[model samples]
Every structure is written in structure tokens, then in C-alpha cells.
Target: MDTSAIEALPWCADLSLNSANIWTVQQGRCAIGVVLLVEKSASVALIRKARVEGYEFSDRLALPGGLVRGVCGPSFAPCFEQSIRARAEEEAGLTAEQLSELAIAAPEFAPVSRYTVKCVERFAAVFTVRANIKRPQKLISADKSIQEAFFSPLPPKWEELAPANRLILARAMRDHAGDNVKTAARASVNEALAFCNDAAATVNVPPVPDPWMSPEA
Candidate 1:
């Protein structure tokens, strides 16, 4: 599969809900896309001091993505596998296709955790991509929430990323060093599937029915 195709997998984002000021365990699944675009002339595609309203990490440098919904929703509707690429195109103004024909360069997976008012869990996935794109441009912040986006060389303080995301990026870097896309993809798919399976198992809430009434009453 192409790099974009691989990145477009239906990765789920976890959200948390609460009741009575106590954190209740509830999960809300939302599809998200993350892009890894590398250009020879660019140092990195990392944006600094970006802003997204209602979120505290406004100035943090991170990958560009947004919540995916039906086309009628705020963001464009993306197919199951193309969601990542679609969001990349929409948010960062970048277009990506499968790089199968090109030499399999580098591939990696990163785990990102979600701890909002909706859910709490360590979400894991491999972040893989080809490293030979021509003249990749700075990501355009189509959404007003983002203040800026650009490329930069991987930072020395890479370990500072959210623990889950850091893990995936570290793995991707190692796989890239070894030029092991196949292995990385396999491992990522397994992990992603396991997460989905576990999440599905928790959604077993049965419907509540009205109280029964006795004819004697």
C-alpha cells in the first residue's frame, strides 16, 4: 500500500465523560488522520506556537489533524483508509499517494493518549511514511485554530512529546533507520486492531427499559 494509504487507516481517538465531579469511564471514538511529510530542503514539518481554541496546548508544536465527520460535518468526509490523507490535504494543504513504487524508505508507529472530559486511555499506532517527497510546502492552517505550521529537523528533545505519541515516533524512527516498513506496518496493524477490540469490549451497556407494572396495581 502507498504511504498515504497506510497513514489513512481508521485510527480512533478516545474521549472521556464524567458524572458528579467524579471521572466516569466513557469512551467516544472519533476518527483522526496524521501526516508525516518530509522534504529534502525543509528542516521539518513541525509547527510551533500553534493555537486551537478551547484546548490548553495552544502553543505546542504538533502534527496537523482535526476531528473527521461526514462531509456535511465541519471537516470533509474521508473514506476509511483515505481519512488521513484527506485531512492532511484539507488541514495542511498537502497531497499524498501511496509510495509503493518508490523504495520503501522509513516507517514508524507512535502512541498518543487521550485524556479529555470524555475518556482516558493510551491510544497506540504506528506512524509510517516515505521520506522522499519533492518540495513539500509549509502546512497551511486552513482551520483558524492553528496559528502556524512548518517543517523542522527532528528535535533533540523528541522525548518530550506526549508519552504515547513519543513512543510511536521513536518506533518509526527506529524502523526508518532499519528501512523496515513491512515489519513496522504489521506491528502497527496488530496493535491498532488490539486497541479496537479492547475498546469494543467496553461498549456493552444494555438499554434501560421502563419499570414493569403489575396488573394487580
Candidate 2:
């Protein structure tokens, strides 16, 4: 992972409460979910690649996702739906139509740690699709950040993923297993959008400084 490149992205600005606390809040990255839309009968998207930096897990599996800007919008469903489609296409070479046919699976609020950063609170939206099309012959990281993409069975090995991603995958799997995939996915998306609208309504909310923490010390 290129720390500099990640930091330079425009979205990085939102990671911090203020400029002075960037590193401390790196884990507070952003929320973006990519559920591998799979047919009800088929339940996994598996891949192989090198773990983090030096470690290697030739047959590793994970859903596609990452931090996103413009996602905290008027509605979380559309934003999440759009982001998921975009990331899948961009990262795994999957298309939107290919995503919609399968059962939409998503993650409820869960905590995950990326690198040393911890997303203290997070949520995701998942969708499923069935494709007779062959999986990519060779997984290629479109963004260079991703290693590969493929499909496998659900309840993937949690210990295999980065801490943050592990939390996400675990929650998604748990939801899928609980028979709450559809309802939870919809609820999460709706809640996200509603939260966004409420927050937007308070755009003019007074910025009262905490007595212990001054804006200008």
C-alpha cells in the first residue's frame, strides 16, 4: 500500500477531524461496501494473492470495497449501490447488470481496522448476481491496490483478511447466514440515507468547541 498515494487522494481530507490528526484517524478512513452479488445457489467470490506486503495467501478470498468520497450523500442506498457497482466493475471487471441478478447481501454496522487505522463505526451494502460468464482467467488489480478477484464459498476465513476488512466480511457473512441478508441490506441503505439527510439538515449546526479541546489552541 502506498501511504503517500492514499494520503494524497482528495478523499483523505475527510479522514481527520482536523489536519493535525491525520495519522491517528487513518482507520477512520471512509465507508464503502462491495458485496459479491452471487446467486442464491452460489455463495462466494474467492481470489488469490499476496497478503498485505510480504505474506502470501495464494488462495485468498474477499469482497471488493474501499474508501469513497461523495458516498455520504442524500441517500445511502443509491450512493452505496452506485459505489458497489463502480468498484466491482473497476476492480473485478464485473458489470452492473451482472451484479443485480443475485441476492443483494450487505453488512450491518461493524468495526474494522485497516492498517493501524480502525473504522470505529462502519456499515456496508451488498448485492448478489448470477453469471454464467467465466470468472476472470487471471485476476488483475485495476487499481494496482487490489491483488486479484474470483468467487468461492461463503463464511470465508476471517483471519485471512486485514483486520478492518475482516470485520466487514464477518458481518456480511453473519447477516447472510442469519436469513437477514435482504432485509438488513435494505435497512442499512435506508438508514444511511436518512442519516445523511439529517446531517445535511444540520449543515448550519453551530460548531461549538469542546472546552477541553480548542479549535485554536
How do the predictions measure up, each by TM-score?
Answer: 0.47, 0.44
RMSD, each candidate, Å? 14.8, 13.8
Which of the numbered candidates is closest to the native, going by highest lDDT? 2
Instruction: Please estimate how well model 1 matches the true structure, expressed as its whole-model Cα lDDT.
Output: 0.38
Candidates' lDDT values, in order? 0.38, 0.39
State, as a TM-score between 0 and 1, how close model 2 is to the true structure: 0.44
Candidate 1: list runs displaced more than 4 Å. Answer: 1-33, 37-42, 52-56, 67-78, 96-110, 117-132, 156-163, 175-217
Look at candidate 2 and tell me the lDDT of residue 94. 70
lDDT of 2 by residue, 1-217 (tens): 1123323434333333223221222344333334443323344554434445433322345565544334435433344456555666766677655444333322222232212224234332212222333433433456555667765545455445433334344444542354454333444433333443333223321121111222356
Report lDDT (Cα) of residue 63, candidate 2: 60
Model 1 C-alpha lDDT per residue in residues 1-217, reported as the tens digit of each score: 3444333433322222222211112243322324444444424454443544544345555554433233332222233225445555555566665212222223323233343433444222323333444554556757555566666565313422333333334443442333353343444434433443343344421111111112244
TM-score of 1: 0.47
